[model samples]
Target: MSATSTVRRFRTLAVPLAVLTVVFLVISLPPYLGLDPAKARLPVPEDVPWFYPALVAHIGFGSIALLTAALQVWPWLRRTHPAVHRWSGRIYLGLGVIPGGVAVLAVAPFGQTGGPTGQVANTMLALLWLATAVAGYRAARARRFGEHREWMVRNVALTFSIVANRPWSMLCIAVFAPEVMGTGPVDPAVLAQAAGVSMWLSWVVNLLVAEYWLHRTRTRRGVRGGPTAKHRQPVPATS
Candidate 1:
């Protein structure tokens, strides 16, 4: 076997792991968000006019996108069922994410969760998410398959941020809480700091990963095509 064989094995592991990741997020994340009007957690006040509705819309469609995107990136589906791939992609970018992102953007100005730092991070995510989705959709329409795939990879990464952002926050509280404040529950301030770091880390890390994967894919395609390499079909989905 070649040195790169292990990379291939790891690549093959991507889809199943992604599916599991989304399932975990869809199940685990909502309770923490305090979607119920009566049981909101910290970083949110007891009551606000537009908060819960926005949270519901954001989480609702975002969850749909998260799960649907996993299937959209499934290698088998992409290869054997291009129509399914295409339609699922539409549902993901159109119904699930764009609206969800817009809803979050709507809520961001209200300074819901994450406060100023989080607000900034979220707003940035919303804009980038929308831009990448639009870029992907437009690329598809123009028949620029390569560009479409790249942008879709980016949009999917941002979508995964819903899962990614939470861990940094929990980890921060876990490590820093006991050490900094000792005993009892940690300060909300520490949580705020964690939230700040997580907001940036979540999507940023995903995008960096996406860039790395795209580079590896482009390189492989070039090698497969050899010196006269030109037209290349999209590779198995690892986004």
Candidate 2:
């Protein structure tokens, strides 16, 4: 392809994701920036003293992870700007995912509505998030680029899982307690149940979708002997 066409293709794919990432951060970060527990977007449990700070930290770092991971997955950046990709990968893994995952562990057990189901689902999500990221990092270190990409796909799926949680929660709430859709006050128990179910639905669905996409890509590339062009163009860690 011509240089101009390559750049055009890059812009086409990267711009929309970049804008969405910015919008997501803009909507997510403002409430937590004030550092007041009372202003948290999620319901803060009165009994868990550390929940607010931990939740805030997770959101803060998760935003960085989201932005950097989005960039890391861009084909144009990986192909032409390998150095930027590696640096961003480091930031995405170390400064963002690690801390964010740790904070998630700290707060997941304290679900938004004090529900056991959410606690379990969120805990599992955090664990898998960290595991996939670490596995991706290890694969990159070993120069197993295909494995790295696969693991990172799973990692990114978990990273973006929060995006799905809101809608799922709303849908669950609407189904479980339609009264919530109206002006009436929400029932705490029903809210908790819906939140818990949504938490499970969000990460589980994202993960399944990621796996399905990976499987389809692999199947399509079976004749070509690899998953993607990325396997053929391994970005060096230093570059």
Candidate 3:
């Protein structure tokens, strides 16, 4: 492989690996090492009986979506078996629509922040995730291949928010949590709220970055000639 190709391959592999590693460490290590959920548990929204189910659905399907996304992006796997990639795409869409949609509904009333900001952020995240996936599928069906690719790229980036959220949360905690940063003592509740805000920020930032990258890549390749080239018609000869 050329140097550029090698670098591209490394990047493709490295991003997923880094994302997965961070997510795994955050979910698994933190709970196991020192972070006690009982201590961490803030008051649940009393009015939302469905909160637990929604939380389960959010984390469950979210994790599946993340793993499948990683697999879909694996260079060797995708290059070797296009069928697997396609099948995984279908599954990812299904997961996003059902579990992700339900999770959104659940979040609106029961988000961690438990206020207007949390509700808005979680609702927006859920809607964006669902919209991007539906848009991607529609584009594929309409044979607007470029749009499909762009939409799917955005959808996957949103899904990867599960991976991105923790790192951003940690950064928020470091900045705002005096206990962690060894400044003066700070309110744990305030730090928790800040972390919740960070989660939404991470996903929004990722979506924006993904869209920018997609536009750049598409523009660089010249809209007339990338993977979507076959979708266009030949110019007719002049008389």
Is candidate 1 or 3 superior in lDDT?
Answer: 1
What is the per-residue lDDT of model 3 for residues 60-142, given as tens digits with 9 covering 90 to 100? 67666766776655766667787897788788777745577668667665666524555677788788888888888888787
Query: Number of clashing residue pairs in every model?
Result: 0, 0, 0
- Score residue 14 of candidate 3 by CA lDDT: 34
Model 2 residue 85 CA deviation (Å) reads 0.6
* Model 3: CA > 4 A from native: 1-43, 74-80, 179-182, 223-239
Q: For each candidate, give its TM-score against the true structure.
A: 0.79, 0.88, 0.75
lDDT (Cα, tens digit) per residue for candidate 1, span 1-239: 68786555446534775677767776666664766666544344445677668767787788778878876666666777899899888888778889999998877756645567778888999999999999989988876777887888889899888787768767755675654455675666766666776787888999999999888888987788652112445456786
**Best candidate per TM-score, number?**
2
Model 3: ten consecutive residues of lowest lDDT = 31-40
Give residue 161's error in model 2 in angstroms.
Answer: 0.6
Residue 61 Cα positional deviation in candidate 3, in Å, after optimal superposition: 1.0
Candidate 3: give the clashing pairs. Answer: none
In order, candidate lDDTs are: 0.76, 0.86, 0.68
| C-alpha positional error of residue 68 in candidate 3 after TM-score superposition, expressed in Å | 0.8
- Give candidate 2's TM-score: 0.88
Positional deviation of 97 in candidate 3, in angstroms? 4.9
